[model samples]
Target: MRQGLTWFNIASLLLGFLFLYLPIALLIIYSFNESRLVTVWAGFSTKWYAEMLQNQGLLNAGWVTLKVAFTSSCFATVLGTMAGLIMSRFGSFHGRTLFSGMIYAPLVMPEVITGLSLLLMFVAVALDRGFVTVTLAHITFSMCYVAVVVQSRLAGFDRSIEEAAMDLGCPPGRTFFQITLPIIAPAVVAGWLLSFTLSLDDLVIASFTTGPGATTLPMKIYSQVRLGVTPEINAVCTILVGLVATGVLTASLITRRQEMRREAEERQAIANS
Candidate 1:
């Protein structure tokens, strides 16, 4: 039996959405404000955006952030995918519990601790805190998220397909690349996206690990916010929000299309069988 939403449920949901989005709505609206004061709207203009474009520091920070995000997410995806495969497909192994726990620890660990620990580790290793350090730190933490996502997908995956492929003389590496990877590609892509977003949004760890001249967007925004909020900051934030939203929506649509195509092919196969 289907349970229809009641008035209370609808009201609660509306309140929740309003709580979440009202601030974002206000920020988007204020991004266009001509006044320097964020709350005091003098007029609407796109000068803030123009100003953002002209600000070389902000632009450089954005570029650095993109570089870190892309590099870290790619590395994280590769490492996390391997971890997920081992945890899901390799069965029990030595120190499995400890390994799994370590992988998940980052998810619940406080950022301050994680950042401080990474900073200390970098210092001890004599690694100059810079783009490489920041990227490494991001990969370390972000990989955990990817591992969890890929593991969840693997948990529900049908192993019979792989088994049948193996029975038909498909080598392990060949079967994984040809069959397993394709089926789980969506999840891997999602994991990469999740890692990318995390890397882009991270501030604390970056602050700890980054050296001079490697300022990321979040660090730049935080520095400016310490002084005061401005229409320019709002403009930057709005742009980031738009970018993240577009990326997420595009990924979702692609995943959905792939899933639908796979389902249709499966249905056709069933009919033929």
Candidate 2:
């Protein structure tokens, strides 16, 4: 019965994965199709790939998206790491629970609501609704993910090492830079990458906040998709899938390295004892 149940579970999971990914797999395959129709197969060719590169509007949107994602990710990483450190280390502070709640509240909230709220806030503040404002909104949303990831890493962290360094004449700032930061560097890096991907993939928030001539890659794709996806879109989708797969593999390697290092530390401590 247990064996049967295990097989059933595996089949179920495989089916679910196929259901989710088959369309994406089809998109990647169709990207090389010579046919203009996405669903039809007309011999493999890289013509669409060249077309994607030559489209001026898409090129501009891609550049804008890159700028927004990079800037938002950097800012989110800084602010999120700080928030994670504070939440993990200073939980006893007054209204700590409230602050943490507020920080995470945005993550679960509906995207439409979050975008609307940001739009209203920008309007009320009289901030020019442009690239900078869109970038800021992305940072605000992306930071929550970074904080969540880094906070999970920090939760498993042993604070005694940092405390010991402080007691041994290392200043708090120095200890953080030298000891605490190094230990969780993998998570921090992962968080930053996550923030970047999330920002790049965003559409609703960027749509609500972006002004004239500030279309992001996702926005460009979305607008065109309504008119039916082109061969160029298939090519773009293939590239994005490749990027996501690469990011996942890189993150997995980093996680594996961190685990190995942790096991080595455990063995070393046992030997010392």
Candidate 3:
């Protein structure tokens, strides 16, 4: 019975992974096809990737996407961290429930509704639908995700260290910067990465908010896809997969290293004491 259950679990895990990654794997494989037709694989070639580089529209869109993702993610991280700190550290402040609800409302909100509402708000304010609008819209939604991540991390955090710092005459701001921030740095970074990914992957909100000269990679790819999927599109998608995979891997390695270093420091401190 035990042996049968082990085999069943292994098969289920393999199937789960196959279901999740098979399309991506196929897309990557087709990216190198010499044929312009994405589905009909011809001889393998790197021409699509080279051609992609030369496509000025794609290049410009990619640059815009990167800029938006980076900018929105940074702002989201800062604002989200502050919100998370307040929600987790402060107990029952005035309108805490309302504040928390507002922070998380975006998470459950429909993307179409959010996009429509933002578009109306921008129009109401006479804001142009362009790069700034898209970035602001992204920050508005992405910050909620960041807040959730940071708040989860802070939920079980040890407050004794912070209390001790305050007892020793450290100002609240100083204690946060010198002690609490370091301990929660991983969570903060994770939140930033999450926000970055969300902003990068977003399409509907970006489309509604963006205007001339600010087309993101997703919008570009989507437009191209509507015309037809080609090997070049496959190549672009493969590149995105590679970039995102590299980022996640790098972050994981850095987080693991930090964890190991923190563990070592804790052991050393205990030994010294």
Candidate 4:
């Protein structure tokens, strides 16, 4: 019975993976098709990739997307890290519950509502709906995700080390930069990566906040998809998929290495003591 159950689990796992990744796999495969029609595979070719590179519109949109994602992720990481530190380390403060709720409200809020609110605020302030607007909108939503990730990491953090540093001559700011930051660096990095991914994948908020000459890759792809799905579109999507996959893999490897090094350092410290 146990053996039968194990086989069933394996089968279920395989099926789940297939269900999740099969469409992506098919898209990647078709990206190499020579035919312009995405569904009809004529012969293997890299022509679409070449065309994607030469297509100025797609290239410009991609550049814009990268800029927005990078900028928003950096800002989100900083703000989110600060918010996480406050919520986890400060214990109780006046209006802490209200503050926490505001920080996390975006997580459960509908994208449409968030986007609409941002749009109205921008309009009210007479802020142009361009790259700046989109970046701000992304930062607003993505920061919440970053905060959640950082807060989870900080929840079980050992405060003794920080207390010890404070007990010593280390000032709070210095200790955070020299000691606390290094220890929680992995979580911060993970949060930044998550924010980057969210910004890159976001379409709704971007659509509401963006204006002329500020088209993102998603908006471009969506517009093209409405007209038709071409081999060029497939190639572009494959490239995005590849970039995101590479980023995730690199982050995982870096996080793992940091963890191993930390473990080794702790072991050495214990041995010395």
Q: Model-by-model lDDT, in order?
A: 0.90, 0.89, 0.89, 0.90
Each candidate's TM vs. the true structure? 0.90, 0.93, 0.89, 0.90
Model 1 residue 264 CA deviation (Å) reads 7.3
lDDT for residue 132 in candidate 4, whole number 0-100:
98
**Best-fitting candidate, measured by TM-score?**
2
Candidate 2 lDDT tens digits, 1-273: 665578779899999999999999889899999999888899999999999999999999989988999999999999999999899888799999898998899899988999999999999999988899999999999999889878878887878898899899999999999999999999888888888888878899999999987899889998999999899999987887776676667766776777687778878888998
User: What is candidate 2's CA lDDT for residue 1?
Assistant: 62
The superposed Cα distance between candidate 1 and the true structure at residue 7, in angstroms, equals: 2.8
Candidate 3: misplaced stretches above 4 Å?
1-12, 249-273
lDDT (Cα, tens digit) per residue for candidate 1, span 1-273: 248878888899999999999999999999999888899989989999999999999999999999999999999999999999989987888999999999999999999999999999999999988999999999999999889878877886778899999999999999999999998898899888888888888999899898998999989999999999988899999988887777677656755766676678668778998
TM-score of 2: 0.93
Residue ranges of candidate 1 with Cα displaced over 4 Å = 1-4, 250-273
> In model 4, how large is the Cα lDDT of residue 229?
93
| Superposed model 4: Cα runs more than 4 Å off | 1-7, 252-273
